[model samples]
Target: MATVEQNVSEFRGIIFLVRILFHADIYREALLSRLIILTLFSYFFQNDWSQAVTKFYRTPLLYERSYLNFLYLQNKFSSTKKYKKVTHCLFDLDGTILDSEIIYHKAIQKICERYGKTYTKKLQNQLYGVTDRQLSIGVVSALKLPISVDDFEKQMTELVQKNLTDSPFKEGAERLLWHLSTSKIPIALVTNSTDQAVQMHAKARPKLFSLFHHKVCITDPEVKRGKPEPDMYLLGAARFTPKANPTQCLVFEDSVVGVEAAVRAKMQVVMVPDYRIDKELTLKATIVLKSLLDLDPTLFGIPAFKDGVKRGS
Candidate 1:
C-alpha cells in the first residue's frame, strides 16, 4: 500500500486535473452557446443583429448591475443639453485667426536692426502675444539690446503698422466666425497687440471683427497685464459676463503664452499652434487644431452649424 504522503500527493494531482477539465468544459460550452446565439441572430437580422441586440438588451434585467452605469451617465449628460449655457468665443489676434505673424516678424526684425541687435525666431516667440511695452522690454532683455525701452517701442509701433495688413484669412477662420455669429454665440477678440494695430486689423477684416460682441486689446489703459499673466483673457471674459466664469468660454490661440494665460484664467482653450508655439506648451489647451477652419459646430456641442445659425443682418 502507498504511504500517507504519497497518497496525498496523488490525490492533490488528481483534484487539479479534475478542476482543469471542469473549467475547460464550462469554457467550451460558453463559447458554443455564444456561437449558436450569434448564428441565429445573424440568420434573422443579418447586418442589423448588433443594433437589434443592443436595443433588446437595453433593459437592466437583461444585463449585469454594471450595465446601468451608462444609463446613469446618459442622465447625467442629458441635463447639460437642457439649458443653453452662454458660450463665449475668445479669439487671439496675430498668428492665430489672422495672418499677422509675418508682419510682426518683419516688424521685430526692423526693431532689432534699429537697436543694433539680431532677432531670432526663439526671441520672437518669447515676445509673441505680448503687448507693445511688454514686448519691447522683453525683447530688449532677451536680445541684450543697447536701446532704451521707449525708443524700441516707438520703432516697433511704426514698423508694425507699415508691415501688417489683413490680406489673407486663416483657412476656415472667416467661416467659423460666421457660424459662431449666426449661432448667436457671443464672441470677443483678445490680443496683446496695441489698440491701433487691433483696430486696423479689425477694419480690414470686418467679418471677424463684426462677429465679436466686444473687443479687448492690450492698448486699453485698464488692461495693465498681457498674455501669460491672464489679464487679457480675463478681460475678454468680462466682455461676455462681467463676472465671467472662465469655465463658460472657449479661447482660441496660436501661442504658448496665450494658452497659458487662458488656462490661468480657468477657461477652455483651443490652440492652433504656429512654428513658434510648441506642442508641449499647447497641451494645456482643451483642443489643438491645425487651423481655425477645422472648427465645426459639433465642437461647441451643437448638432450642426447650419442648424443653430441665426442669420445676422
Candidate 2:
C-alpha cells in the first residue's frame, strides 16, 4: 500500500489532469459526462461516495476562484502608476549634478589640519547638507579652532576652487540633462554655493552649464535664507518664463537639507544621496534613487530613453 503522502500526491495529479481535460476545447461537449465519471472514480478510490461527489464538485469551483483571483490581480496592478507630470526641473549643484563634495571634504580637511585638528567623518556627515555659512560655522566649532567663520570660509573657498577646476559631472548627470534639454524641458541649477563658486564651476564646463534656463546661487539677493529654507527654490521657480507652480516643479537633490528645502517649497523631490548619508534622512523626499544613473525619467512624466540608446552616448 502507498504511504499517505504518496496517496495525496496521486490524488492531486489526477485532479490536475481532470481539470485540464475539463477545460480542453476538444472535450468541451463531453465535459459533463467526464466529470460525472471522474466523480464516480473518486468515490471508488476514497470509499466515501457522498463526500467524493462534493470534493469533485468543489474542484471546478476552486479553479474558478483561482481564475477570478488572477484577473483581480491583473486589473489591480494595471491601474497603478508611479510617475507624475512636472513643468520645470530644479537641480542642486554640489554632490547632485557635480561631483564636488569630495573636493570640499579635502579642502576642509586641509584647513582642519592647519589648526592641528582632524576633520572626523562624523563631523563631515553632520555638515554634509548645510549651507556655505552654516558649514563654515560648523567646521570652526567642530575643530574648536580660534579662527573667525569668515576666515575659515575664505581659506576653504580658495582650496575648493583649486580642486574644482576639472570636477566632472556626477554619474547620470550629463545623460539626464541632455535628455531634458533635447526634450525642451525647462531646467535650472539651484545651489547653496556662493556666486564665485558657481562662476568657477561654470568656467570649468561652460557648455554644459549654459544649458540651464537659470542658475540660482545662494548669494542671489532674493534668497533670504539658505536651504532647509524654501526661499531659494521658490525664487528659482519664479524665474521660469511662465512661472511654474511649486507643485509643477521637480527638484533633484543629494542632501537632506536640499530635500527639505524642496519639500517646503511644495515641489516634488528626488534625492540621490551619497553613500555615507544615513538612509533615514532621505525618507522625506518624494523618491530616493541610488544615483542619477538609476533615475527613470518616465516616473516624472518625462520621455524615457529609447531602448538601444546608451547613457551618455
Candidate 3:
C-alpha cells in the first residue's frame, strides 16, 4: 500500500506541474478537485483519514503559511487610508484641560510690567506648553529682562500659583474627562508644567485631576526634552500598567507644540486650540475640534457616550 503520505505527496507533485495556473478560477477548480479526491481517499484510509485531510488542507493554496502571510500583507496594502485604534489617552494640561493660557500670559505680563517691558502675543504663543526652563529662558532673552533665568522662573511660578489655583476648566473639559474615566479608559496628564504647577492647578478640582492614571511632567528627572520633541508623550504612554506603545495612545492638546509632540511620538492627537491660536498650527493635529464638546470618541476607537456627552455641570 502506498501510504497516505505518499499518495498526498504524489498529488502535490502532480499539482506542482500546473503551478502556472495563476488565474483565480483555474486555481480554485484545481484545489476543489484535490479536496474531492482527498474526500474519496479518506473512506479507504479510515485511521489515516485525519492525517491525510490535515496535510492536504495545510499544504494547498500556495501552502497555508504563505497564504496567510499574503492575506495579511494584502490587507495592510489594500488601503492607504490610516485607521486609529487607541486604548490609552494622553492629555496636555494647561490650555487643554484648564483655561490657564490667560493666567500664564497675565503672570508673564506682570513680570514684564515690573521690568518696564512688554509680553508680546508672539512670545506668549511660543512659550505656551513648554518647559519652565524653556519658558523662563525664552522670556528673559526675548524681553531682555534684567532678571536671571532662575529669577524669572521663581516669579513666574509664584504668579501662576497665585492665579491658577482657581483657574477654570476649558469648555467641555470636565465632561470629557469624566466620560473617559467612567468608561474605564486609562488617561494620563502629559504636560510641560512643573510638578508644583500641577499641584497648584489641581487645588480646586483634585478629584478630577486624580482621575488621571499618571501625570508626566516634563520637569520630571527622566524627561530630557519637552513638547514638540516627543520625549514626554512617549514617557507618558510607557507608564500604563501594561505599558502601551505610542501607536496605542491618543493625545489631546490645545497647543501647536503639544500636537507636534504627539505626532512625532507616532501617536494621534486631537487639537482643541485657543481661538487666538493660528489656524495653520492647528492643522498639524490628526483632527481639530472647536471645543472638546465637538469630539466624537468613536472616531478614535473609543467608546461613545451612553447619554451623548452627559448633560449638566
Please report the candidate that would top TM-score against the real structure: 2
TM-score of every candidate relative to the true structure: 0.65, 0.72, 0.70
**Candidate 1 residues 1-313, lDDT tens each?**
5578755654553353333334333443343234335534553554443353445444445433212222222223333543223377788877777787777677888778876778886687676666678778998888888878898888877877875773467766777777777777778889887788877877776666877788888778878877888888888887675446677778888888888998899887777776334323554666565656444446456446553433310
Show the lowest summed lDDT stretch of 10 residues, model 3. Answer: 69-78
Best by lDDT: 2
Error of 3 at 275 (Å): 2.7
lDDT by residue for model 2 (46-132), tens: 766446656755565643433333222322333354557998999999888888888888899899888899999889899997877
Give the TM-score ranking, best first: 2, 3, 1
Comparing 1 and 3 on TM-score, the stronger one: 3
Q: Output the lDDT of residue 264, model 3.
A: 96
Taken over the whole model, the C-alpha lDDT of each candidate is 0.65, 0.77, 0.75
Q: RMSDs, each prediction?
A: 18.7, 17.9, 20.8
TM-score of 1: 0.65
Deviating ranges (above 4 Å) for candidate 1: 1-86, 114-116, 241-244, 303-313
lDDT for predicted candidate 3 compared with the true structure: 0.75
Instruction: Give stretches of model 3 more than 4 Å off.
Output: 1-82, 309-313
Which tens-of-lDDT digit does each residue in 1-313 have in candidate 3?
Answer: 7888767855654353233233224443455445536644663566454465555555545344333332223222323536588899999988888888788788888999998999997787776667778889999998889989999989988888777876788888888899899988899999888887887766677799899999989779999988889899999988999899899898999888899999999998888766555443565677666678767788778888776553210
